[model samples]
Structure formats: structure tokens, C-alpha cells
Target: MTLTESSQSLDELLKPRRLFRRLIAVIADLRLAIILLLSIALFSISGTVIEQGESVAFYQQNYPEDPALFGFLSWKWILILGLNHVYSTWWFLSLLVLFGSSLIACTFTRQLPALKVAQRWKFYQEPRQFQKLSLSTELKTESSSSLIAQLEKKGYKIYQENQAIYARKGIIGKIGPIVVHVAIIVILAGSIWGALSGFLAQEMVPSGATFGIKNIIEKGLVAASPLTKNWLVKVNRFWIDYTPDGKVDQFYSDLSVVDKEGAELDHKIIHVNKPLRYDGVTFYQTDWGIAGVAVQINNSPVFLLPMAQLSSKGSSRIWGTWIPTKPDLSEGVSLLAKDLQGTMLVYDKEGNLTSAVRPGIPLEINGVTLKVKDLIGSTGLQIKSDPGIPFVYTGFALLMLGVMMSYVSHSQIWILQANECLYIGGKTNRAQVSFEREFLQIIEEINEAQTPTLSVANEIKN
Candidate 1:
């Protein structure tokens, strides 16, 4: 092989490494990090505005094409962009992972080195070195030991080289930014884990029904199926409580977690805001509806009829069913109930309001004595399992702690004693006025005879 060709080949091999370094540098840049965070925020807001993890028909009905939302967003566009499942989408997770990498890179490449420099102490040997400090001054005072004692009293750690001295306090201030970066990275980890392992489902179970989790609205890429345990949940009873004015106060579901053989393991009476949690799975009561009603005509067996909720614009809910009074099913009456309060409105064959009756009341309709028996109710529940919640909470706590620690000023002072003249200087990350006052006190104590020379405190006497 020719030498020129081999050199070109080697350059090609090294090109990838050079490109990798450039990419890493760009990712570690603060501007890129800000842009990434903003992009994530914008997309998160989109996730909220557009309903997530819903059926295709729901999106189609809600975001139809002819007069699209925002003049452009249709259901097809939403589906194509994966906006319906933003949190679980690959691009969203990629943004999170990339932002976390940036944080880690910045912590190692910038923050750690900066912290190391702040903690390392070196005495200022030359007068020119002390001249560079804004707070430095040449005091014709000889007492350097008194300065060290006063600094120590003010919570500064002292380091000395021959007659030159260095003191610092609040090193935790330097460490705080790094802690913040770590906390953010931990939060990202939790979010990624949750998006990859959590699951959500909804169930509308009738009273006295037993079933395993079947309908999953959304599931992570690696979610553990809730059906793995083969556990069955039975809705022992469902009911609604009403106020004196007949408004629904609350609804409840008596539930039991059982095995395949119907052996009960755990039980709870769940209502709104109160849920049943078992083995990392939680069931929240969300809604309630009438399932059916039972009726009997004189001496005949009780017949169960399924009830369907009617459409209404207000909070008034009503479920209705038609019961045939004649055997040929030619004549019938409609039974409608607004609540489980035993009161119902009976409608005649011509849809006219016939009578208002309650359970156990005999109402003569179509030449028969009909008695209302019972009303069955159903409970709607939302079930979810998120294993990353603990990590997210821990990271949140660390973030708060780190933010508080960052507020502390990392004050540093340098004093060089050359023969009779003592050179003193100091700097701090925050609270400039307070640090200046403290520096003044240290100076005054070091030279009790001569008025201390630092930032002029002449206005103090005024």
C-alpha cells in the first residue's frame, strides 16, 4: 500500500473520534441544555392539551378534520406524531436521556473542576498577586496571628505557607451546583423508568361481579402485566349516598381482592379520593352508574332488566328500561330512575308521564299489578401501577436541599505577611455587603492600634 493512501485511511478512522468529541462538546453546552429543556416543556404542554391514551374513535370524534383544532391539528396528525402517548413516545424519552447526559457531562467537565479549584488553598507569595484582588490592601501592621484567630472565629479554615496564610469557609456552596445536577439526573432516571414500566387501565364493574384486569388503556414498553398474579377483584356491592335534598353526596364500592379459587386476601370500601392499594397496584373509584333494575308482576317471577343512561346536559342523571306488560310484548311502559333512592317515573305507551312510584309500590299499568323490586349499580375504577414514584420523590427532596445549600456564600480570604507589611484580601460568591463587613471586622481586630485599611468604611462614621 502507498504511504499516502495509508495516511488517508488512518485519517478516516480518526475522523469518527474527532466527530464524537465535537458532538459531546455541543451536548455539554449550556445553550443546548436550555433548548432541550424548553422543547420537553412545550411537548409536555401539548400532551396535556391533547387527551392521552384514548381510543381512536375518541380522538377522531374530538379532533375532526373539516374544521380542525387550531386550524390545522386533526386526529390523523395527532396519531402520526404520537401526541396521544407523548410520555411513552421514543422521541420524548430520547430528549430526557439526552438532557441527563448533558447534566452528567457538565458536572464532570465543569462543576467538579470548579469545585476542586475553590477547595484548594494557595498563599499569595508576591505583592502583585495580592494587588489583583479587588478587596486587597497593604496594611503596615505586623500581627498576622491575630488575623488568623479572628478569621477562625468567623468560621474560616486557615492554611499557611511560611508567613503567608489562606482561609476559606462555605465550601458547601461550591458543592451545591454539582448536587443539583445529580438530583436532576436522578429525576430523569425515575421518569424514564416510569415511562418504560408503568401501566394504566379502566374498569366499570357491576355489583357482585368478579374479574381480572383486562382492559389496558396504556402500557409501558416493559410493563409487568397485572394479570400475572391471576388475582381477581370482586365488587361486593356498589351504592350511592344522597343528601336530604336528594343530591348525590358520595358513591362507594365494597371490593375484595381474591385468588382464582375465590379465596379473599384483601378488602376495602373505596370511595372518591380513597383507593384500594395492593402489591403496587392501586384502584381509584372514579364514577358510578345504574346497571339494572328488578321488577315483578303479581305472582310472576322477578325479571332483571338492563338499564341504559340517557343523555342530558346537566348533572341530573337518569337510567331507563322498558318492561312489557303483555306476554305478546305489544304493550309496555318505560321505567326511569334519577337515583338509587327507590323513586322512579313511569311513562305510558304514548310517552306521557303516568305515575311516580318507589320500590315495593304496586302500580296498576296495562291491567296488571306491577311491583318494583331492586336497583343494581356499577362502579367505575381507574387502576394504575408506577414503580418509579419513590425515586422521583427522593430526587425532588435532594433538589430542594441542593438549592438551599447553593444560597450560602463561599467566602475566601488570603493574607500574606512580608516582613512588616501584611497583605489581606478576600472574595465571596454572594452577600457582597455582609462579606465586606466581616472582612472589615477581621481587619480592625488584626490591627487595634492603626485604623484598618480595606474597602473604605468611612461612611460608617457618618
Candidate 2:
């Protein structure tokens, strides 16, 4: 081959090698990993601070154009940046992918090699090798078997070659970082999978209502499959308990999961913090409101009037409904209720206070006697389908395990027997003082055992 042609081919080969090295350096860089972690944290915090999956009207109302929040953030920016749903954003997913790639690179380039180095046993063949250790000692001994026993008693894996001996403990310390990286990768994979295939929906159903999964607030890109539409939910009943002092104690809803063939699959009494899970979907009771009230007017048939919840903005909850007293639907009394305590405030058409009446109590308004009947309650439920929850939980468990394993100190001891003299040395990745103390204790035992043997040899020589 011509010299110039061969040089060109070599250069072409070197180009890919150099590029590969550069890529590895960038992915394995600790600083890059830290920066990516911090960026992920910052975006996660933003996701928490700013509400997710709200309507455009909600954002427009909260973040107006005239005066934006923090002097910069507005509804337009939120929509454009996909801050309305941060976790499912393409950029966030890409960040997770890059961080995972960094972890893989670091694991392969740093952690595994370190573990292999730790697991390899290298016996000290020469006396001078003892000088290289952080802790070294010299003693007169004919055999290293007793010293090896002492090391083994201290929880070390022993390796012997002729007159040389090598021992180590806590090999898991070297493997811990790799396990941690794997756990983090698993968690990231779970999060990414959830973001891709999970969905969130909300439902406000009155008692005795059967409904399908509708009103999706947020859903993943690939979550609109037929599996989400296969099941049905039924809110059998909803009620609230009141304390003796007229405060709400707890609210509950009886719910059932139904199949496509109208068969009940499961049933549960759902409350706040106590959710029901079935078919990878969880139903949580998030809120409750008054649906309607039944009332009898002047011995007439009982009629149900739907109650509308009034905007309290941060105040107490209140639901109101207008009851027509005249045939023209002009003259009516407004009923306002604050709780399920069976008490309501009645107001005349002129907005004047008429009277307060409880359930089963009679009140005279506009010369007509009204008897309050039962009040129906509605349950606010949040439904979510996340297939990655198990993997995420497992990853966290492994993370804790890795953290514990990392705390163990990997220690190594080498003993070389040269003629009648023994060279002993040791080192540890952590807990230097403790290892030193243990090394000293082993040396003392070796000296005590050898003293009797030396005395017997001296007696024989005499």
C-alpha cells in the first residue's frame, strides 16, 4: 500500500476512536451528572409549585396578561413551554433519557472496573511490597497459618499462595455504587414509562350514578388506547359524618368497578388517603359536595332541586339552590347550605333572610309550609392508571439497599513470610482507625502464639 493512502485510512480509523472517547468522557463526567441531577430537581420543583393539567381558562384567570407572576410568567408562556404538564413534556423525558445514559456510562466505565479491581487478590510476594501499604508491621513467625486464621475470624475472604497470603472483606462496598446507579436507572425508566403510558382523569358523580372513565384532565401520548375505555365505575352511595359540634368528621363513598358486561368486579368504601385499586387503576376520593335537596311544599309531592356550589375562593364551602314558589318561576326562595349538618339558610326573592330550617323541619315562607327532605351528596373522584408504580417502588427499595451496602468499608490485608520473619500490612477504603486497631489486635495474637513456639525451640537448642 502507498504510504499516503495507509496514513489516510489510519486517520479515518482514529477519528471514530477519538469521537468515541469524547462521548465517553462527556457521559462519565461527574460534573455533568451533578448538573443534570440539579436540573431535574429544579424542573420537578417547578412541576410541584405550578399546578399541572388545568384548563386554559384557569391559567388565564390565575395568570393574567396585565401583571404576570414573578414579572415574567404568564398563561401564554406556560402553554408554550408545556409547563401545564411538566412530567410528560418531551424535554423532561429527554432529560431523563440523557441522565440514564450518563448513569450507564459511569457504571460501565468506573464502577464495574473498580469492583473487579477490588475482587482481584494480589499476594505480597516480596518483603519490600509491605512498605507500600498504609499500615505495616514486622514479626518473627515460621508459619502464616495462625495469622490467616485470625484474619478469617475478622470476616475476611482469604487467599493463599505458598508463603504469601492475601485477604479482603466488604467487597460489597465496591459493588454498591453500581447497584445505586442501576436503581436510579430503574426508577428513571419507570418514570419514563409512566409518563408515556399512564393517564389521569377526574369524575364528580352523584350517589346512585354509574359512569364511564371520562373528563380526562391529563393523559400520556400513548394512553388513549381501548383498554382505558373497557371498564366502568359506579358510585353507589356517598355520605358524610358530622361530629356532635356540627363539624365534618369524615366523608365516604361506596364505589364498585363494573365490567363491560355489567358485572360487578370489585367494591370498596373509598375515603381520603384510602383509595381503591383494580386493573392497574386507582380511584381516590378527593372531594365531596352537595348534589341536591329533596323538599315537600304544602303537602305536595316531593321534588328534587339540584344545588350549585358557589365560589368561596378560600372561604368556607357553600351550596345554593333556588326553589320556585310561584307558577311563573319568578318568585322563588334561595336555599344556602354550608355542610351536611341538615341546616340551611332560606332567603326570599328580595335577598332578605327568611328563616333557617333543618332536615325534617317545617318552615313557613311566602305563606307556604315547606318540609325539608333528604339531601343527596356527590363524590369527587380522581382516577389514575400507572403501570410503572411497582418498578418505581422496587427501585427505591434497591436504592436503600445500595446505600446501606456502600457504608461497608472494603479492607485488605497481605502477609508475606520471608524465612523466619513475617511481613504484615493492610489498608482500607474507609474506617482507617478501626482497621488499624484490628490489625494491631491480630499482631498481638500472632506474637502471643509465637512466643511459646520460640521458647520451646530455644529449650531444644539448649
Candidate 3:
């Protein structure tokens, strides 16, 4: 073969081999584990620092360009790679999956064996081996059978074939690590599953407004009920009562939930803390907003505002215009009113006037000044739907139960036999100090019981 062709073939063969090796190295590296942990921390901080799911322009406007550093965390690649939304990032998810698998693998390869070793009970009569233990007691006595019988009476199965006694307590003590590791696996799996499959939205449906499915924050991926295609909800009336300190003590909404095509599915009165659930979708009284408002002029009269006006022929058209106080004035205002700033304008039938008004301030028009008498505030609600939430909650409950059980473990001791000399030992799966105290008490009791009473004849002779 020609040298050029041979070199190319060698390069092709080596390239894939190098790539394969690199991939394996990356997967096995401890740094990857550290990276996963750090990423979790980073995401947690990010969630707290920056408002998530904001518009792209918001980040740009807020964080201006800097010559030294990249544009204030602005990277086209970030959006494309889903770094802007780290919760949905494939790499982050992959890290979680890897960590979960590692936990499972570690459980099987390391923890399981350790647990088995801990669970297994072996009769070790060697004093040297017993001396190495964290807690041990050596009792030397002339009669081995009596000592073995004493241990048996104490609820310990003692092996006494050799000169020394062998007994073990709390055989299940070895299984602690296994249970903990497996529980960790279950918890992590539940968390990941919930993150991927759960749907949560906080939509403020205004009173008397029907909401379409897409109007909610979590829209696209939500499934429809088999019986009803779309879950329709209408907020009939929303009431919020706050404490004297302005803290929201309670809130509720009178609502009617319907199926697609306007069929009443259910009626519910949901509150801030109480939610209505049906067909795997939970309807929460999270919030309410201004669908439309009755426009009042100087608090004198109210006018129903139309969203849009349509022509009589059924063609849609919107008609509305802001009327200044002085319609005849030439110019007295800038057209913009946003960001808490109200535009000031001067206008006279054939002349110009100058005046400025903030949103909360009043403006004089014609001859009288009009004030913004009231404002209708919108409500904020949080909604969540997850088929996996139950699993997640169950796992958390189990985790808490296991921790409490391990922390508050109950230990017991039984005295097999007590003769002139006896064997004493107790087993505890948790709180070794407490177990030791209990065992000491038992030993003390046995010693007291074995104490010989001075006979009356011997006492009188003395």
C-alpha cells in the first residue's frame, strides 16, 4: 500500500480507539463524581440567584456586555445546550442517572457483602479476637457448663465447645448499611423520575374566564383524561382574606371544571391549602388575575371594557383609544406609560400644556384632576401534576422512617443463666452506649442475685 493510504488507515483505526478509551476514562473518573455533586450545588444556587425561565432578552438587558468576560453569562451555546435551564439539561440529568446507577452498583458490589458479613454470626472463642472488638468482656470461671447454661438463660445462644465462650447479639446489625444504601437508591430514582415526569404550573385564571390547556405554564406535555380530552376550568369567584399584618391567612376560589366542548365535569371549592384532584390532575386554587376590568371615570361611573369589538358581519375588530382630558390640545404627552412611570402631557383645544403624572399620582385634564382611585390586583397560584409524586413522597417517607428507626432503635437483653459465675452479653443495632448501660444494669442485677446471704448461725457465732 502507498504510504499516504497506509497513514490514513492507521489514523482512522487509532482515532476511534483513542475516542473509546477517552470515553471510558471519563465515565470511570472520580472527577466525574465530583463534577456531578458540584453541578447539583451550582444548579441549586442558580435556582436561588436568577429567576428561571425568563425571556432571553431579559438576561441580556440586565447583564450588559463586558470586554474581559463573556457577555454576562450570555452564550448562544448555553441556550442551545439547555444550560440556561439546567433542570432540563441532558448532561445534568445524565449525571443524576450515573450517580443513581453508581449507588446501585456500590450497593451490590460493596455494601451487600459488607452487610452479609455483618449479619453472619460466627462463634469466636479466641480471646485475642474478642479483645480486638469495640466492646468485650472476659469472665474466667472454673465450671464451663454452668457459664454456658447461664448465657443460655440470658437469651444468648452460647457456643461453649472450647474453653472460651462465644456469643453474639443483634445479628441484624450487619444489614444497616445495606438498608441505607438501597434506600438511597430508591430515593434518588424517585427524585429523578419526578423531575422528568412531573408537571407544575401556577396559572391565575381571572374570575369568569375559561382557561384553555395551553394557557397554563405547563401545557404541552400534560396528558388529557381518557374520559375527557381537555380539562376546562373557570374561576367563578375568588376571595382572599389577609391578616391584619397583611399576611395571607386564607384564600379560595369558587370554580367549575368542565371537559372539552363545555361539558360540566366537576364543581369544586378549592382553597389555598386544600386542592381538588380528579383524573390524575390536581386543580389547586393557586391564583386569580384580571381577565378584564370595569373602567371607572373618577369613581363616578363604571364602564364594561370590551376585549375586542367585531363588525356585525362576524368579522373580528378591536376598537379602543385612550382619550386625554383635553382632546382639543395640540400636544401635552408622551405616549408611553410603563415601569411605574406615567406620561405627562399638556394639551389645550388649540394650544399646548405641560404636566407629568406618576401611576399613583393624579393628572388635571380640562379643568379637573382625575385620580387613580383603585387597582385590582392579580393572584399567584402554583399547580403541580406528577404521576411520580406519590412514589417520591413514599420514598421520602420510607427514608425518614428508616432514619428514625435507626436513631431510636430499641435494644433488649435476656439473662440465660445465673449460677455462682455467669456469662453476660447484650446486642443492640443502634445507640451502643445505651445498650452498654442496659447490659451493665443486667450484669449488676445478676451479681446482686448471686450474692450469698449471711446465715443467722454464722452471724451469731461471729
Off by over 4 Å in 3: 1-35, 66-72, 75-83, 140-167, 170-173, 200-204, 216-228, 239-252, 261-263, 269-276, 282-289, 294-383, 408-432, 435-439, 453-462
lDDT of candidate 2? 0.90
Cα TM-score per model: 0.89, 0.94, 0.62
Which pairs in model 1 have colliding backbones? none
Error of 3 at 8 (Å): 31
Which of 2 and 3 is ahead in lDDT?
A: 2
RMSD of each: 4.8, 2.0, 10.6
Candidate 2 on 279-348: residue-level lDDT in tens? 8889999889999999898989999999999998777999999998766887779999988878899999
- Tens-place lDDT per residue, model 1, 1-462, is 999999999999999999988887888999999999999999999999999988999999999998999999999999999999998899999999999999988998899999999978988888788777758877887767777778888889999889889999999998989989999998999989988999999998889999888899889999998889668899999999999988889999999999899999999999999999988889999988888999998779998999999988897888999999988999999999888889899999899999999989899988999899988888999998887777899899999999998999999898888868998998888999999999887777666734544335565655
* Least well predicted 10-residue stretch by lDDT in candidate 1: 449-458
* TM-score, model 2 to reference: 0.94
> What is each predicted model's overall lDDT from 0 to 1?
0.90, 0.90, 0.53
Off by over 4 Å in 1: 1-15, 313-315, 327-330, 449-462
- Candidate closer to the true structure by lDDT (higher is better), 1 or 3: 1
How well does model 3 score by local distance difference test?
0.53
